[model samples]
Target: MREDAVKEGDKAPDFELERQDGGLFRLYELLKEKNVVLYFYPKDNTPGCTKQACEFRDQYEAFARLGAEVVGISSDTLESHQKFEAVHHLPFTLLSDKGGRVRSLYGVPRKLLLLPGRVTYIIDQTGTVRYVFDSMNKPLEHVSTALEVLKTISHERNTQNV
Candidate 1:
């Protein structure tokens, strides 16, 4: 990660992109409602990407129950994301990063100086980035790790109000 990269405890940088459905999605807007599991993948339809997405899909309901939303992003086109989402029956939002601007904002590093890196950020409803996991090889870990963090956040919030 770069020195200016969004880090844990920092307020997540707000941005908008064209979603799979062609609607504008702003991070700050989403932060108003639920904690976000904002993940950045390399591309669409690739084997690893597919499995990572499906892992999120399989755990979609659990994320919702924990008051978190799962969102995937990449430099792929809206059309490509639409196809990938339908083919995999992905139940979450997929955003098209036209020129990798958002990825750059988050300082998502590239793998082997070629491929875009796989990274996941857990941002709470208050817009603070609670956690970040950047692993090029562990796609499935993104889902499980994010869920664990969200569960902890939920527990903390409940205890805070008690």
Candidate 2:
């Protein structure tokens, strides 16, 4: 399959998706407020997705302190997200993209017929995609890698303003 993922410096296509918590999230709105870590996973409650979610949850406070918000998207329904979050104590937003529309906008590939491919996007404060990770074998590294990019950008912006 062709990798249609957005590249760094490209304006990320904003989307409106249903949250597992019964709310609507506009990607641009969140980007306007803070940098975003938009991650896409195969399925809710699955092994890899769960590991990715928990790692984000564990470091959620640091992400917030860095003025970034982490959000996960999957084709799963709101009910599934709710159950997964409750069972794992996830501390951030879980978006339910049942239609896979948002997933397609992000160009998340379909590696498995049964699961959405593992991918993550780090959006800068200006709403541009700063980084994209498409590998599923090393899920935990996704968080750290995204954080490093965000921190570098945040530092550079601060330095320029000073």
Candidate 3:
């Protein structure tokens, strides 16, 4: 496997992309409000990607309760994302990274250096990457791992306040 270009404690590379609704989503802008769960998947409507998206969708409320926003990114076009969102009833924002520029920027290594990689990044409000989970085969594990990391971060913050 290729080494990840970004890692925990690194400042997440900022990006702006067109969301499914055609509105631009700036990474730093979203970071100002809440922690961001940014996930990259291979394609829209594919079995693994669909399962991963729905898993994130199912756990979205839990994430929000913990002050995190879930955002998905793919090389798929905005229209494809729109249909994917609607069809899956995904509540979170899906961004279009048409050329996989954002993915490449993050150094999300492609599976076998061919297919797009599956990776999840948990970035704190300050725009630092708190955690990263990368696995092409274990799609659903991304949701569980991200939630665990967020909960840990929340707990740490709470303890620090006391």
Best by lDDT: 1
Candidate 2 regions with alpha-carbon error over 4 angstroms: 1-3, 112-114
lDDT of 3 at 81: 94
lDDT of 1 by residue, 1-162 (tens): 878888999888999998899889999998989999999999898989999999999999999999999999999999999999999999999999988899999989889888999999999999999999999889999999999999999999999999
Best by TM-score: 1
TM-score of each: 0.98, 0.95, 0.97
Q: Determine the backbone clash count of candidate 2.
A: 0
Q: What global local distance difference test value does model 2 have?
A: 0.87
lDDT string, candidate 2, 40-154, tens digits? 8888877888899999999998899889999998888899999999999999999988889988887778876665788888898788888888887888999999889888888
Alpha-carbon error at 26 in model 3, in Å?
0.4
Writing each residue's lDDT as its tens digit, candidate 3 over 50-136 gives 999999999999999899999999999889999999999999999989888999899998887689999899999989999989899
Clashes per model (N, Cα, C within 3 A): 0, 0, 0
